[model samples]
Target: MLSLTRRIREEILVIDRQTGEQIVIAPTAYRGNQVKIGIEASDRFKILRRELQGRERGPGPG
Candidate 1:
């Protein structure tokens, strides 16, 4: 894992060289020890929390 320090509104981007797709993340808010982040990515990407990665998926309410 790579770690870097970023101030609020400063962005870090990750790109896929093969597909030319990218994700931009930034720190939007911070209070005490908690932080709120903002991410910008295309619809082709699926983003989820680390804790929910292994959970099974089911249909949502209709």
Candidate 2:
């Protein structure tokens, strides 16, 4: 696992070396103790929050 610290609007990109696919994540908003993030990725990705992974269905294998 990797950890990153980014300011709002600063993006961190994740790339799949094999497929050359890319996902961009950035912090969009910040409150006192919470932050909102935005993600930009191809439709091939089934993006989900960690908390929702258990409830997600029909997710194809990677």
TM-score, each model? 0.85, 0.79
Can you tell me which runs of candidate 1 are displaced by over 4 Å?
Answer: 57-62
Model 2 ranges with Cα > 4 A deviation:
56-62
Model 2: pairs clashing at backbone N, Cα or C within 3 Å: none
Residue-by-residue lDDT tens digits, candidate 2, 1-62? 88888899999999999999999999999999999999999999988988898783787899
Query: 1-62 in candidate 1: lDDT tens per residue?
Result: 99989999999999999998889999999999999999999999989999999999899999
TM-score of candidate 2 versus the correct structure, residues matched by position: 0.79
Report the Cα lDDT for candidate 1.
0.95
Clash count list over all predictions: 0, 0
How much lDDT does each candidate structure score?
A: 0.95, 0.92
Best by TM-score: 1
Clashing pairs in 1: none
